[model samples]
Structures are given as structure tokens and as C-alpha cells.
Target: MLYDLFWQPFADFAFMRHALVGCLALALGCAPIGLFLVLRRMSLMGDAMSHAILPGAAIAFIAFGLSLTAMSLGGLLAGLVVVLAAGAVTRSTQLKEDASFAAFYLVSLASGVLLVSKWGNNVDLMHILFGSVLAVDDMALCFLAGVASITVLTLAVLYRALVVESFDPEFLRATGGGGAWAHFGFLILVVLNLVAGFQALGTLMAVGLMMLPAASARLWARELPAMLAIALGIALLSAYIGLLLSYHADLPSGPAIILTAGLAYFASLGLGRHGGLLGRWLRGRHLEA
Candidate 1:
């Protein structure tokens, strides 16, 4: 039963093996970033940024067809542009950072759709909108793994600064610790991961993988380290379940993976030990009794 359910699928298909590895890499890189995003109450930023990269990718697609280098470069450039422009708007106007991000992403999303629908075919648009892990080639897998490795290393270096800034930016700034650079670096990492992930999960569902597992972990852990670990576990498990569902049920791979994460999030909401609704209610009843 185990082999048929788990091992057989992978053993039977090379695409399955490749997809599993890609998902593993994505989870490893995105989970910690997702956790930090949640802690900072900037969860939607992931979604926004995902969309914000679409225009560049779409333009690159129009200009260069399916060239991976062009797509990556275009997406990175577009994401950085949005990030910087949003920062400028925040600094120069009364609008908050989130508001600025929201405005920019809306424009970016619309522009991307317009470009793709106008210049590209349905297949091109679909690929850009919803990625196919089954299509992950050797080069794509290497890209995913490299992004994960860099993300892990960068996060390790920035962990202390990130934690401090997430909780209290003023505190990080007051100590002459170059919190600005850390924040910029973190944003760069976020864009890099999203750009890499968009190839496998697509723009629409990429943030779901990043956010859902992290949100689920948030309900189960009080400490950052614990939350990070829980999110990683959930992400890995969701990726496996999602890949199996995609393979067996003929569902779209990206949505299947994200739906698995959604399941974990709901389960945590109801049954998780820390700060879960059930746990909170049970404790309240016990205290009253």
C-alpha cells in the first residue's frame, strides 16, 4: 500500500521525481521567508509581489519567447522597480507602504495580462499564469535548488537583523545596525524566490505555497524557530500530497499543491495546539470549571 501510494508513483515516473525535488527546493526556500512575512504582518505582500513580477515576465515572454534567462532578468527588474517605486511613494506621500504596494501591484497585474493577451497565445498566457511542475527540466531544477541554497544562506546571515526589524524597526535602526540594508536585502530575497517559484507554481499560486504553510505554522508555534520548523514541515508535506493529487487525479499541479497547503492551514486553525480555536476554547472551559 505504501509503495503503491507513495514510492510507486515516483519510481514509475521521471517527471514525478523531478517535480518532487522542485517542490522540496521551493518549500525549503520559501517557508522561512513566509514565516518572517507573517510575523511582520505583511503576508499579503507575498501575493502582491508575485503579481508585481508578472508584467516583466510577460514582457520577456513577448520579446524572447521562452528564454529562461530573459524571463528571470525581466521579472527581477520589474519586481525591483515596484519595490523601489513603492518605497518612494511611501516616503514622498501620505500613503503607507502597503497602500503603495497595493497600487503598484494592481497596475502591474493589469499590465501583465494586457501584454500577454495581446502579444502571446493562450498557451503562453496559461504557462505564465499557472506554472507546471511536470515541465520542470534539469536546468529548471538546478535553478530552483540554487535559489533555495542562496535563500537558506542569506536567511541565516540576516536572521538576527530580520527578527529585530520585524518586531521593532526603530530598535534595529537606533542601534546603528544598518536595518535599511537588511530590509532591502530581505525584499531582494523575496523577489528572487518569487521569480524562481513563478516558473513552477505560476504567479497566481506561488504566494499560496509561501503563505499558507507559514500561516498554519503560526497557529502552532509561539517562537520563531519553532514556527520556521513547523512551516517547513507543513510545506514539505503539502508538496508531496499535492504532487500525488496532481499525478493521480489529473489536476493542475500548482493548484493541487496550494490546496494541500490550504488543508493544512484549516487543520491548524481547528486543531493546532498553540492558539488554535479548539485549544483556546478548551482552555477557557477548563479555567471556568
Candidate 2:
């Protein structure tokens, strides 16, 4: 039964294949970064940065028409600028990271909306906001593959510095390595993944793709390496299940994928053995008797 449903979609429709492949690439690229973002308490930063891409995307569309490659590059640059500026503002002022992020994201979102309205072309707005995974073409797929490869390679090469800087920047500095550079590099990776993902997931939910699986994994794992593995597994599973659901239900792929990740998060919260609601409830019952 299951094979019958998925076989037609996979074999007959090129769009279905594109969507599945694109989502898988997003999963792999996002999982590790998501885990680190959670560890560094920068999950909100990821969210902020995702939304900050909207203005850039709108401007790119206005200037050069609906060119996916150009818009992706423009969005990437905008996200990077916002994140860097937020970091600088936080370091130089008394405002917290979350505060800076919230402020910037709101401003960017409003500006993006206004720009799109001023351009007087409302045709592609839906694509920018909600995403159109079924519209993925060969060029977009190639771009996604390249971005994913670069992101993975950079993370592998900088793994040690990233780990040290994430867990203990002071110790990394004491060991004669500059933690700031590592942080900057990690932020760049985050921007790249966000841009790559935007093509399928849109700016609104791009950060959710990066965050939910990793957050779910944290509920079950105690160590960073284990958490990373679990996060990756969860991300992949969510992508597969989400794609199937979207195919069957005729729903939007991005939201379906995000909802699948959210379901995993809730399952982890409720049933995980380490510190879930069920675990706490069982312990309480045993103690009461």
C-alpha cells in the first residue's frame, strides 16, 4: 500500500523527486548547525536571521526579476549583515543577543513587506513567503547541492574550533585560538544554510527546519556527539515523512515538513526517558507510593 502511494510520485513526477532531494539536502545541512545553535543559545538568532532575508529577496526580485540564484545570493548577504551587526551591537552595548535579534528581524520583515508593496508586483509574493518546493528546477537543485557541500566541508574542517568556541570561548582563547573568528565562521554557515533552505521552505519557516530536530534530540541525549547524531536522524526522518504526507494530502511541502519536525519535538517532550513529562510523572508516582 505504501509503495503504491509513493511509487507513482517518485517515478512519474520530476517535481516530486526534486522536492524529496531538496528536502534531504536541507536536512543534512541544517541538523549540525541547529545542534550548535541550540548549544550556544542562538536558536533565536537563527530565527531572526531567516526572517531578515526577506528584504533582500524582495529587493533582488525588484531589481533583476525573479532569478532564484540572484535572490539567494542577495538574501545570504542580507542575513550575514544582520547577524554581524546584531553581534556587534550586543558586544558594544548593554542589549542582549535576543533583544538585538528581535529588533533587527522585525525591522527587516517590515521593510521587506513595504518594499514588495512599493514594487507593485504581487505575483511572486506567495512563492517568497510560503515557498514552492514543487517549482524546484535543475538549476536550483544544483545550487542547493553546492551550498550543502560547502557547508558540510567547512563544518568538518572547523569542527574543533567550533566545538571549543561553542562550549567554552574563554578556554579556547586561553589555548591561543581566537573564538571570535570561529563564531563568525559559524554564523556564515548559518546564513548559507538559511539561503539554501529558503528556496524550498521560505524565509518564514526556514529556521524551524534548522531548529526543531535538534531541539527534539536534546531531550533524549546528554552528550554533544550523541545529540548531533540524533538530530541528524530526526531531521532525515522528518523530511521523508513530511514529503509523503505532503504528497498524499496535497498540502504545502514546507509546512508539512515543519509540522513533522514539530511532532517529533512534542513526542520527545512527552515521552523521552531522560527528562520528559512521562519520565517525570513516573518518578513522581514511584516517590509518592
Candidate 3:
């Protein structure tokens, strides 16, 4: 029963195998990016970029009729534009970054919805918004793999600079470091991963995969390296169990994976050793004793 429920789906179906591979790749790529976002309090920024890519993807679909390369490039350009515009709006105007991000993402979301409605069919829109993981082709797989490789290597190369910039941008700059470059590089990685994630999880929920595991890890781990490692493990486990559930229970794969991550986050909230609800309660009881 266990094999039938868990292993058979993947073993029997090529699509299932492909989906598993894609989710694993997403976990590998997005988890680290997510840890940084959580640490920097930019979880919402990841969500914004996910949504911001939608209009560009929609435009690409309209122009090229579902060409993966075009849509990916368009999404990348759109994310970059939103990042730049939001930064400019925050720095040049009096608006805060969050407010500017909100403005930009909302506008992008509306534009995407309108474009999809006007130029595309429900099938196309559904695929873009909710994703069709079972339909992942060779091209999509290559794209996802490339993004994962790039994200991992880039994070490794700039690990120290990113850490310093995240914690002390002012200090980094004062010490004659390229904090701005690190920030931009990190944002670019975020965008790239979001685009890759959109292929499997869709625009609406791609950031969920990134943020949820990272947030859960935050509750359980104290150090950055521990958090990153824990986040990656949680993400991979979520993907594995989520795929099984999606197969046996007939759930949406993307949402299933994301909801599994959510469960981990909530579980960590209660049971994590670092600062969990149970941990704090136990400490309190010990103090009273």
C-alpha cells in the first residue's frame, strides 16, 4: 500500500517523474534565496516579484503563443523593471519600499489579468496563473535546471558580501564594499528563481515555496548556515510528500506542495527548539520551578 500510494505514481508515470525533478530543482534553487529574503524581511518582495512577472509572461504568450524562452525572458525583464522602479520610487519619492512595492505589484497584477483576459484563453491563463506541472517539457526542464545552477553558484560566489549587506548595508558601504552590487545580485537571483518556479508552481504561488520553508527554518535554527540547510531540507521534504499527496488524494500539485510547507511552518511555530511556542512554554515552566 505504501509503495502503491507513494512510489508507484512516480515510477509509473513519466509526468510524475518530471514533476518530482522539477520540484526538487525548485527547492534547491529557491530555498537559499528564500532564507535571505526572510532574514532581510523581504518575503513580501519575493511575492511582489512573482506577481510582477505575470504581465510580462502574459505579453509573451500573446506575442509568441506559449514559447517558453520568450515568456521566461519577458518575465525576467518585468521583474527587473519592477525592482528598479520600486527602488527608484522609494529613494526619489517619500514613499517607503513596501508601499512602492505594493503599488507596482498591484498594477502589474491588474495589467496581467487584463492582458490575459483580452488576448488569451482560459486554458492559457490557467496554466500561467496556476501552473501545469504535469506538462513540463524538455525545454522547461532545461530552463529550470539552468536557473537552479545559476542561483546556487551566484549565492556561493557572493555569500560573504550578501551576508554583510543583509545585516549591515551601511557598514559595508562605509568599509568600501560593494553593498549595492550584492543587493542587486541577490534581487536578480530572486527574480530568476521566481521565473523558474513559475514554470511549475505558477505566478501566484511561486513565492510560497520560497518563503514558507525559509520561515519555518527561521523558527527552528539560530544561525544563517543552519537556517539555510534546514530550509532546503524542509523544502525537499515538502515537495516529496506533497507529490505523494497530490497523486493519491488528487490535489493540485503546486498548492499541495505549498500547503505542506505551510504545515511545516506552523509545526515549527509550536515545536521548534529555538523559539517555538512549546519551547518558550517549557522554559517558562522551568523558570517557575
* CA lDDT of every candidate: 0.92, 0.87, 0.91
Worst 10 residues of 1 by lDDT: 1-10
Q: Estimate each model's TM-score.
A: 0.98, 0.95, 0.97
Model 1 CA lDDT for position 239: 94
Descending-TM-score candidate ranking: 1, 3, 2
lDDT of 1 by residue, 1-289 (tens): 9788877889999999999999999999999999999998999889999999999999899899987789888999999999999999999999999999999999999999999999988898889989888889898899999999999999999999999999999988999878989888999999999998898999888898899999999999898899999999999999999999987898998999999999999999999988899999999999999
Greater lDDT among 1 and 3 belongs to 1
Q: Which stretches of candidate 2 lie over 4 Å from their true place?
A: 120-123
> What digit string (tens of lDDT, one per residue) describes model 3 on residues 1-289?
8788779999999999999998899899999999999888888988889999999999998999888899999899999999999989999999999899999999999999899999888888888998877778888888888999999999999899888887888899999788888888999999999999989989988998899999999998889999999999999999999998888889989899999999999999999988899999999999999
Off by over 4 Å in 1: none
Evaluated with TM-score, which candidate comes out highest?
1
TM-score of 1: 0.98
Residue 81 displacement (Å), model 3: 0.8
What CA RMSD would you report for each candidate?
0.9, 1.4, 1.1
Regions more than 4 Å wrong, model 3:
none
